[model samples]
Target: MKVNCPTCQSEVEWSAESPFRPFCSKRCQLIDLGEWAAEEKRIPAQATQEELERALPDIEEIEAMLAQQGDSFFRDH
Candidate 1:
Protein backbone atom coordinates (compact mmCIF):
# COMPACT_ATOMS: atom_id res chain seq x y z
CA MET A 1 0.00 0.00 0.00
CA LYS A 2 1.23 3.51 -0.80
CA VAL A 3 1.69 5.96 2.05
CA ASN A 4 0.96 9.67 1.82
CA CYS A 5 3.87 11.94 2.73
CA PRO A 6 3.03 14.52 5.37
CA THR A 7 5.06 17.27 3.72
CA CYS A 8 4.32 17.26 -0.04
CA GLN A 9 1.44 14.80 0.28
CA SER A 10 3.09 12.65 -2.38
CA GLU A 11 2.56 8.90 -2.44
CA VAL A 12 5.46 6.77 -1.17
CA GLU A 13 5.86 3.10 -2.14
CA TRP A 14 7.82 1.78 0.80
CA SER A 15 7.23 -1.64 2.34
CA ALA A 16 5.85 -1.65 5.85
CA GLU A 17 9.15 -2.85 7.32
CA SER A 18 11.54 -0.96 5.01
CA PRO A 19 14.27 0.93 6.82
CA PHE A 20 13.57 4.02 4.73
CA ARG A 21 9.83 3.76 5.20
CA PRO A 22 8.95 7.43 5.64
CA PHE A 23 11.18 9.00 2.97
CA CYS A 24 10.54 7.68 -0.57
CA SER A 25 14.10 8.59 -1.67
CA LYS A 26 17.42 9.84 -0.28
CA ARG A 27 16.84 13.25 -1.86
CA CYS A 28 13.61 13.66 0.10
CA GLN A 29 15.37 12.71 3.34
CA LEU A 30 18.16 15.21 2.74
CA ILE A 31 15.66 17.91 1.80
CA ASP A 32 13.79 17.37 5.08
CA LEU A 33 17.05 17.63 7.03
CA GLY A 34 18.00 20.81 5.18
CA GLU A 35 14.66 22.36 6.06
CA TRP A 36 15.21 21.59 9.74
CA ALA A 37 18.75 23.03 9.67
CA ALA A 38 17.81 26.16 7.73
CA GLU A 39 14.67 26.87 9.73
CA GLU A 40 16.34 26.13 13.09
CA LYS A 41 13.05 24.47 14.09
CA ARG A 42 14.55 22.92 17.19
CA ILE A 43 14.97 23.85 20.82
CA PRO A 44 16.66 27.22 21.25
CA ALA A 45 19.57 26.69 23.54
CA GLN A 46 23.08 28.12 23.72
CA ALA A 47 24.14 24.51 23.07
CA THR A 48 22.38 21.18 22.58
CA GLN A 49 22.15 18.84 25.53
CA GLU A 50 24.54 16.33 23.94
CA GLU A 51 27.02 19.05 22.95
CA LEU A 52 26.94 20.74 26.34
CA GLU A 53 27.59 17.42 28.08
CA ARG A 54 30.27 16.08 25.71
CA ALA A 55 32.20 19.27 24.90
CA LEU A 56 34.26 21.32 27.29
CA PRO A 57 32.96 24.82 28.02
CA ASP A 58 35.47 27.46 26.94
CA ILE A 59 35.13 31.13 27.84
CA GLU A 60 37.74 32.13 25.25
CA GLU A 61 35.81 30.34 22.51
CA ILE A 62 32.80 32.55 23.38
CA GLU A 63 34.83 35.70 23.99
CA ALA A 64 32.25 37.84 22.17
CA MET A 65 29.59 36.83 24.69
CA LEU A 66 32.09 37.41 27.49
CA ALA A 67 32.59 41.02 26.37
CA GLN A 68 28.87 41.67 26.75
CA GLN A 69 28.72 40.46 30.37
CA GLY A 70 29.51 43.22 32.86
CA ASP A 71 32.97 43.19 34.48
CA SER A 72 31.36 42.86 37.90
CA PHE A 73 30.04 39.43 36.88
CA PHE A 74 33.48 38.11 35.88
CA ARG A 75 35.16 39.90 38.79
CA ASP A 76 32.91 37.93 41.16
CA HIS A 77 34.24 34.75 39.50
Candidate 2:
Protein backbone atom coordinates (compact mmCIF):
# COMPACT_ATOMS: atom_id res chain seq x y z
CA MET A 1 0.00 0.00 0.00
CA LYS A 2 1.06 3.62 -0.59
CA VAL A 3 0.14 6.70 1.48
CA ASN A 4 0.97 10.40 1.58
CA CYS A 5 3.39 11.75 4.14
CA PRO A 6 1.62 13.74 6.88
CA THR A 7 4.19 16.57 6.68
CA CYS A 8 5.20 16.89 3.02
CA GLN A 9 2.22 15.08 1.46
CA SER A 10 4.73 13.06 -0.61
CA GLU A 11 4.00 9.51 -1.72
CA VAL A 12 5.31 6.88 0.68
CA GLU A 13 5.27 3.09 0.56
CA TRP A 14 3.58 1.37 3.47
CA SER A 15 5.94 -1.52 4.13
CA ALA A 16 8.25 -2.86 6.84
CA GLU A 17 11.29 -2.05 4.64
CA SER A 18 10.29 1.66 4.68
CA PRO A 19 11.90 3.01 7.86
CA PHE A 20 9.49 5.99 7.92
CA ARG A 21 6.18 4.47 6.86
CA PRO A 22 4.01 7.57 7.42
CA PHE A 23 6.70 10.04 6.25
CA CYS A 24 8.76 10.11 3.06
CA SER A 25 11.98 10.56 5.02
CA LYS A 26 13.36 11.43 8.47
CA ARG A 27 13.27 15.13 7.50
CA CYS A 28 9.50 15.07 6.93
CA GLN A 29 8.96 13.12 10.13
CA LEU A 30 11.08 15.63 12.09
CA ILE A 31 9.22 18.53 10.49
CA ASP A 32 5.89 17.15 11.72
CA LEU A 33 7.39 16.61 15.19
CA GLY A 34 8.72 20.18 15.21
CA GLU A 35 5.28 21.55 14.28
CA TRP A 36 3.78 19.75 17.26
CA ALA A 37 6.62 20.90 19.56
CA ALA A 38 6.09 24.52 18.42
CA GLU A 39 2.34 24.27 18.96
CA GLU A 40 1.70 24.90 15.25
CA LYS A 41 -0.43 21.76 14.98
CA ARG A 42 -3.35 21.49 17.39
CA ILE A 43 -6.54 19.50 17.93
CA PRO A 44 -9.61 21.78 17.82
CA ALA A 45 -11.53 21.96 21.09
CA GLN A 46 -13.53 24.58 22.99
CA ALA A 47 -14.58 24.20 26.64
CA THR A 48 -15.36 27.11 28.94
CA GLN A 49 -14.93 26.87 32.71
CA GLU A 50 -18.69 26.73 33.24
CA GLU A 51 -19.09 24.12 30.50
CA LEU A 52 -16.36 21.94 32.02
CA GLU A 53 -17.82 22.23 35.50
CA ARG A 54 -21.22 21.19 34.22
CA ALA A 55 -19.77 18.34 32.15
CA LEU A 56 -17.91 16.68 35.02
CA PRO A 57 -19.46 15.48 38.27
CA ASP A 58 -17.88 16.67 41.53
CA ILE A 59 -15.36 14.30 43.16
CA GLU A 60 -17.44 14.04 46.33
CA GLU A 61 -20.54 13.28 44.30
CA ILE A 62 -18.65 10.60 42.36
CA GLU A 63 -17.41 9.02 45.60
CA ALA A 64 -20.91 9.06 47.09
CA MET A 65 -22.40 7.51 43.95
CA LEU A 66 -19.69 4.82 43.84
CA ALA A 67 -20.23 4.05 47.54
CA GLN A 68 -23.95 3.63 46.93
CA GLN A 69 -23.27 1.32 44.00
CA GLY A 70 -20.68 -0.72 45.97
CA ASP A 71 -18.02 -3.09 44.57
CA SER A 72 -20.58 -5.43 43.02
CA PHE A 73 -20.43 -3.36 39.83
CA PHE A 74 -16.74 -4.26 39.34
CA ARG A 75 -16.95 -7.98 40.22
CA ASP A 76 -16.16 -10.40 37.36
CA HIS A 77 -18.82 -12.96 36.48
**Candidate that scores best on TM-score:** 2
Model 2: CA > 4 A from native: 39-77
The alpha-carbon deviation from the true structure for residue 43 of candidate 2, after best TM-score superposition, in angstroms, is 17
The lDDT values for all models are 0.42, 0.50
Error of 2 at 69 (Å): 43
Model 2 residue 74 lDDT? 26
Off by over 4 Å in 1: 16-19, 40-77
Question: On residues 1-77, what C-alpha lDDT tens digit does candidate 1 reach at each position?
Answer: 88854434456776855344465543333334334433433323343335433442333433434456433432212
Deviation in Å, model 1, residue 74 alpha carbon = 41
Clashing pairs in 2: none
TM-score of 1: 0.37
